[model samples]
Target chain A: MATIADVARLAGVSKSTVSRALSRPEMLLPETVATVQDAAEKLGYVANSAARFLAGGRTGVIALVVPTLDNSFFAPIIGGAQARADAEGRQVTVAVHSFAAGESLTTFGRLARQVDGFIIVAPGGSDDIVRAAATKPAVLVDREIEGMSSAVADTASAFTLVVEHFARTGRRRLVYVGGPGNSWQDAQRTAAVRAAAERVGVSLEVVGPFPPTFAAGAEAARQVRELRPDAVIPYATALGLGIQHVYLVAGETPPVVSSERAIVEALGLAGVPAIDVDGRVLGDVAARLLSQRIQDPSGDPNRVRLSVPVTWGA
Target chain B: MATIADVARLAGVSKSTVSRALSRPEMLLPETVATVQDAAEKLGYVANSAARFLAGGRTGVIALVVPTLDNSFFAPIIGGAQARADAEGRQVTVAVHSFAAGESLTTFGRLARQVDGFIIVAPGGSDDIVRAAATKPAVLVDREIEGMSSAVADTASAFTLVVEHFARTGRRRLVYVGGPGNSWQDAQRTAAVRAAAERVGVSLEVVGPFPPTFAAGAEAARQVRELRPDAVIPYATALGLGIQHVYLVAGETPPVVSSERAIVEALGLAGVPAIDVDGRVLGDVAARLLSQRIQDPSGDPNRVRLSVPVTWGA
Candidate 1:
């Protein structure tokens, strides 16, 4: 491959002159521009992007790692990152740990070299593993490792919204279906559900830590029938489907509190009331945070939380 | 960048000796391997991946390109691809196209060069564009363009199954909520729904090539009320949520048909029978096809379709 020196030698000019000819073509004579272009092409030289990018705002790609794409909860956040990346002309490369089978850690470790930064969603790695990953510019989504920058929604507020919604709907014995025990979102959601119900003077049963899937949702629904909670609020959309299905079958009204805007839109058609979180905005926040880390790798990692509620067709 | 010749000159060996030392090290003399390794490190000569890939069987990364990861329909396919790639000691770099932002073509065009090979969800571009993408070994998912190899699901068969399921429930009037109109899957699905409904002597209304969102599904439901269809069969899980919600609010049952396994699970919890096509299976087939292409680019491109009826809940 052609180096700047090769192009310079071929063009009968200094390396700085060749660089000026390519990057600041307007400042150079037209003849110099032609000579540099020709020589560069002849040597099959493509300018090193990272070296050139050092002086610019930024446009190198970032790797956004998600547990799975199936969950409605994660898609908007991922989408937000892509939109933001595109705006800066930095491409987003998606790497799903869910698909990596058993070699996710190794796979992710390898990706550390390729991306300028990362957006890790509830990375299922340990503290040491996470620390190793943070050597590269990265932002955690819905998770806060001990030392990484993070952007997350306030689950306690999200839970409070659910409890309040249920109380207004005249549901006293409400149930909450939580996500897998390991998920930070699920843990926070679980805490919020328990505490919110107590504060609201409502009887609540926490039925999960279930795997986030439609099957798990169906299983949670069977549990809901047994518990007979006045309404069921699954912590997120993946489980919400099954929870809602059980109530629909029982000819009952079950309200949901979720970050799934898509689900909210779906439920709106059926006149199913819900407390919606603007996941896209969360995604946007997450993107901004990731960009910050990529721009300055030495900064102290910050944790930020924000939320918005959408009560549509209520 | 250090070339093979540069490493050879530094190592006091020929280029052929350096190539053998780096790629087929086991076949080289111990002294030769040590000299080459030392020389490579001294000169900062990491083998160019593209050239090394041609010389060997592995690049340790697999690339996938899809129209959008935000669409739940592709989740299982991506998951399967990721899992398989992970098992094979490969990591995935996915590029998602945002139609809303007019970004797929540009994003994909840029992504194709950075990875070892690509797994394209749709042969989305014009013939010239498709041919350009085809230059890199790739396997298409669920779509078969004129000159590309693909792994397609029997969408026609699946559509027929949905119609059959609807008819079995003694429901005559039906509505088919279509997928993205620009997608080949959508065209095939619409045709199947029409042909199958005609064969079964049933009246069916077709709505949308909409954005494949819950809002689109809900809107279709609103239209369904006007059309007085007995059932609403949507093309995707997000859409299924919409149509199902509309019917639920009306205190009615409109059996849903979708390829979304999540929706099917939700419906099963509600006892709303659904027809599901296994997306994971579709993904697996696509992965194998892409791997085959990468392994033998000079071979004729083969297009294969895999279809299986989903028995609802399971």
Candidate 2:
């Protein structure tokens, strides 16, 4: 129940001075800022974030919006964003939004009014939705919008390495299991893999627009069994795990490659080839981009693409 | 840029009526609420949550606080909490806090002013930290504090089943690997296993206050190898995965029992005995309890302990 007036009186400053000290300390002397902070802490005078937002002041909070947490892929991303945000002296509020077509615009609008800006990880989101949601400063992860900033993993390039490895290992027939049909990353990977397979003169087939889940992977594995490809490339780690489980149960060991090294190692898939995609690094890059975007909204939007390393396992 | 006054004029209602229609629709007639909603939507009117909080109204937002997202165990819990919050017409904001001794109090103090309540999952937190953080309505997960609502899994009793199974299977020596040192759940599990072993006259040894991670499990595995127990009970699935990997690499298949079925199944540990602990259900229960607490802060606190089913695997 401590008031701003009490803090001002205790710190021997005017009301406007107190407000400025709390909201825009960079504009004031460090000693004055320290005095105001000490007084506020002594009296337990927490500034009302809602009032600050109404006054056009920063909330010092960032929103990290993801499609869902069911996929283990997003967990490290969240952790990385949270850690980077903490380092920048900002708090992260994670919002799980499916980004379903009709509801996303409204969700974005409401969320935009609450946080300073956003770090959005919506791989399957359409460009139209991105345009609508871009009303606020946002950095897209694993996807690119025409005029927005993005942090993307070079999975497309990594797929080329996978294809070359398959070809070198005498895996003539190759099948690529795709994830979430609308995913921008999936489209890029598919295109890259197709081009690489054509260059290598290997027979290639594409199957599934399945969800990036273990259960869905099992279903994809069944259809894949009939196709009988010598090498398999799954778009997500969960899909690779599912495919591997089904094959192992049937006592078959078709060559499988994944782009997630952490999950592969944890699951004891030492013999499987994997491309290292550090989600934490991807998250850190996206958050840094978002922080820069928030500070300079009119700056030319930058795109950062990180390299993926492939490990040919034993 | 639509205002409440604009929506009120369009709907032919007072500004106060417009506010009530949006915030407390249950108090108004259904048709009146519909008219106000339609008018607001047509005008693109989004209420400022900060302004609502200034006026002493509910924010309709909940915070789900977890220690960290490094462990895959918390992902499903977050998903379930978000699902339930969406059903209740509330938004979920996830906060990651380490619950370190001195810092958690301040963190909780700031977060308390922003959200309506909290769903806290801090297994390694101390009683003092929980007490200090309980300034707002909070429901504990996997830990019990007196005079507070909690949703806990009965892992203690489940450990008894694990011990009984070890006895029935003619495993004379048992090793129990514990999780975080300060975790209440770990204490409960260790005590239960010790009692059951005593009753069955089986030689038992306790090891590790290790972190609930795969790498830590590998470290614990080294020590367990020295102990040479016939059966191993790891406090977490990640630990079980790590221990299993190390043992399998060395061409040993010691019986490992875990209390997390999802991760075990996903990792293809079909032959490992697992006690089913549905994290989604735990999250749903905790969110439901927190929602109730928010509505009735003066009500008696409730504790709900969910039963864990043991799967004696092949």
Candidate 3:
């Protein structure tokens, strides 16, 4: 049977280099890894994954845990991570915490022993609990923890962009619908919008503690109409659509700025103008940072802060 | 730390019975299992999950692989499996196949050694690929495989209900907007709708092979209007909303039927009537079957066919 040695010989690299290329491609040059992979493929050399797992006591699997899957925000993150992991012949396992008490901790504990590392997205637990349970290589996405590597979106900038758009369009009486009270991004966006609204001298009323669902948006639309905001900024697509539905029914069309393109597209199909906070970049950046951390577990903490690019569409 | 012996003594059961209750509660009477659980809780016994994993050569983690997370259809299934697994002190890991070439097979290969069981939801690949890779205790959802356990929803009945609704309303010129061709449910739904429409003696025009996105729905809406059907049945909520959006824009409203409650609720908030096919039951049943098979891998294969319950709401 063809083996690593044959691939190393064929690729003109040492056997250890070939091993690193297979196991920790992030640590090696892309060209070198590609060459190794090509040679391995040409030789019909398939790595015995089970034998390797037995020898190293590692599962060749990494896990990404999020709070929920009902939202589209987490979909891209999973896609980016899975894409990157698949390129290196690794697999990523996703689990949801559902914000249930002791659930995240239990998941981390069980998977920490089985998988090589973990990437936790928007952990809704105390840092002490996460820190205690995460004994393996780990990275955080959309939230930051002291002494841990993380990748976060520039949410404050996203809100600033939306508020600036409202100002540019001469919109006054702006109402901000908040997301879940426990969400870090929701808190950041609320604070940013309040500051920006004050700077722009527009009347801003922030209302919610909404759970970021379509139903929540439907319920919040009544309050939005009462406030009589000319412009509405909702933290989720479902909420944005709900508010838009309200205006459409009332025969009064108002601008609704959303944080996702999907919401904009859905409303735009009905000729409603909206702004989107580009979240697609979050997943790709988080995946890169996570892969780097996983390849070299003892490396210095690396923080990636991605700016939110705003797009106005009709 | 409390041990199994202490719990067994307190619960007045043998050690083997206590172990069976913990691992495979389906094998024991519900009352006896409840008694054992109560005793364990009273005694403050925390199972050493990691030690048990090492001793049994099992990871204490089950895996669920889906085609994509872009749609909300799979959310309930995930929640059901995760909730059940959590109750038994087990973790459910999720992975996406993305329907790429050999993707499901590769995922199954990588995760097979790391997890004790698997529940693959709506596999997009050939059945042979799935049957080949699934050597561990496994259950299928939304699709069936010969010689394997499966849980499938009754798509035929759902279409019959929608067709009957159309017939009852005396609506003619029915248009059916279809989902992706490769989607098993989409194919099943399309065939069922065609058969039912014929039985109802309605003229049916099926359009699509669309990607089931808002944009695709928007595009399909243009075609739908040209067809000028009195009622339209979209295979998915996105398409139905798209069709509805077109009508609302043209200032000519037509009745649209959707298969999800969320879509119905969103549009119903605008006073539109719609039908919902509950997918919430898929996950719970699949989870239960998977758990049973995992506990008794040598048991007879079980097939569960869930009837679709349709609800019409404003």
* Number of the top-ranking candidate, with lDDT as the measure: 2
DockQ, model 1, C-alpha based: 0.27
List ranges where model 3 is wrong by over 4 Å: A1-61, A85-91, A98-117, A123-137, A262-301, B1-61, B86-91, B100-108, B111-117, B128-138, B262-280, B291-301
CAPRI-style quality class for the chain A–B interface of candidate 2: acceptable
Q: Give the TM-score of candidate 1.
A: 0.74
User: What would the per-residue lDDT of candidate 2 be over residues B1-314, giving only the tens digit for each residue?
Assistant: 67789989999999998877765565688788778877987885643544554465465678889887777678878878876875565667777886877552444555565678999998876787776787778999999999999999998999998898878878898999999898899999999999999999999999989988766776788889888888889998657656754665566655655545554555455555678778899999999999999989999999999998987543
Q: Tally clashing residue pairs in candidate 3.
A: 0
Candidate 3: residue B77 Cα off by (Å): 2.0
lDDT of 3 at A143: 78
Lowest lDDT block of 10, candidate 2 chain A: A104-113
Write candidate 1's Cα lDDT for B1-314 as tens digits.
67889989999999988767655555677777778877876775532433244335344456676666567667778778876665444556565643333332433433443456777776244445555655468887877777678888886787788787778878899888877766677888888889989998899998877777756777777776778777677777667665666677678765644445555554444434455556677777777777877777878888887865645454
Candidate DockQ values, in order, are 0.27, 0.32, 0.22
Q: Summarize candidate 3's per-residue lDDT along A136-170 as a digit string, tens digits.
A: 88788887778888888787787787888888788
- Measured with DockQ on alpha carbons, how good is candidate 3? 0.22
Q: What are the lDDT figures for the candidates, one per model? A: 0.67, 0.78, 0.71
Q: Report how far residue B152 has shifted in candidate 1, in Å.
A: 1.2
**Model 3: which residue pairs collide?**
none
Which scores better on DockQ, 2 or 3?
2
Alpha-carbon deviation at A257 in model 1, angstroms: 5.9
